[model samples]
Target: MSTVVEILTQIRPEFDFSQSSDFFEDGMLDSFDLVTLVSELDKAYGISIDGLQIVPENFQNVAAIEALLSRNGVVP
Candidate 1:
């Protein structure tokens, strides 16, 4: 999962992925952010985050995102 941090950092190094939980609510991840994140996640985890998984609740936080990734066998 640490690699996930690396990937996130590569996407948005300014954001603190560790303490960040309100990715959507807090405006940390906007529409453009989601697009970038999805792209990076697709490449890093080898799983495509299609429109079906692009929901507010799913990508709201790191845990939620990780859960979604894990469900698709992307993260462990």
Candidate 2:
């Protein structure tokens, strides 16, 4: 959980990371946010997230992001 929090914090420090579901509803992250996040994740986690994988379903919230990372064998 801390790993997820750390990642999310690095991406958006202003976000209230305790509530992962509110990320989109609160407009905490936009399209460009996803792009930057994906790049960061690729470098930080040593995993590549292709263009097709960059969808709202995969990046809507912290849990979703963590799931995506987990699927790619990332620690988070």
Candidate 3:
């Protein structure tokens, strides 16, 4: 989603999220970023991301994030 890219860019403008597959493995995002991202995602998509859903795997890339949103009953 373009909104996903926009949110990520707002969080960390230096990196090109579209080019990265694994944000954590590639060192593109840290734990702090993850926390902030969760907050942003929750607000932007109207879905709460917490507990086990906050794992690294769910925040690894755009695809993973999309899947997480879907699991949380968010359409996209």
Candidate 4:
């Protein structure tokens, strides 16, 4: 699976995603970015994260994204 940072970079390489705890609050990501991220995540991890898991909390940071991926059957 691609790391959250990697996927995020593909979507928005201008920002550094690791320095912030809340991407949304920090203005690092928006709703459109989130949708693109979900698509990349599914393609990279072979795990489908449906709408239920596409909430802000689940995408706050790298840790949150990893946790979400784990819940969706990703190993790490």
Candidate 5:
């Protein structure tokens, strides 16, 4: 999940993603950040994340994000 952490870090370097799980609720990620993250994830993982999957739960944490990617056919 280093790649996922890398993407998150690239978006917001101030917060420590490794120590957090509430990216959305804690204000670590706003809608604009989510959009940028989605774009980066699509390019990095060759996966498309849209529609309902754009919800906060999917982007709440590293594990949740990984689960979303897996559900979208990405191995990890």
Candidate 6:
């Protein structure tokens, strides 16, 4: 599995996330997905993401999500 997928297995997507450049824009993810992803990310990275950091820009794609984890102090 891709790193991003590994980090978010709790909210498994039927489609391959790696194929999408922008999960939100592509309709691969939505508001409910974001909430589930955030919870999964927090658990996987052992960091609490700030409520303010939960934005579409931060979850636009795999790279963006990785960047968000880095911002939360999860070693890249």
For model 6, residues 6-68, the per-residue Cα lDDT tens digits are 654446547677777888888878899899888877776677999999999999888899888
Q: Report lDDT (CA) for all predictions.
A: 0.76, 0.78, 0.89, 0.89, 0.89, 0.79
Q: Report clash pairs, candidate 1.
A: none
lDDT of each residue in 1-76, candidate 5, tens digit only: 4489999999999988888889988888999999999999999988778787888889999999999999989976
lDDT digits (tens) for residues 1-42 of candidate 1: 346667767777888877877777766677887888778788
Cα lDDT tens digits, model 4, 16-47, are 98899999999999999999988999999887
Better of 1 and 4 by lDDT: 4
Model 3 weakest lDDT span, ten residues long: 1-10
Best by TM-score: 4
TM-score of each: 0.81, 0.80, 0.92, 0.93, 0.90, 0.86
- Stretches off by above 4 angstroms in model 3 are none
Better of 2 and 3 by TM-score: 3
Global lDDT of model 3? 0.89
In model 6, what lDDT does residue 76 have? Answer: 49
Please list the residue runs of candidate 2 whose C-alpha ends up more than 4 Å from where it truly belongs after superposition.
none
Predicted candidate 3 versus true structure: per-residue lDDT over 1-76, tens digit per residue: 4478899999999999999999999998999999999999988987778788889999899999888888999877
lDDT of 1 at 45: 74
Give the clashing residue pairs of candidate 3, or none: none
Clashes of each: 0, 0, 0, 0, 0, 0
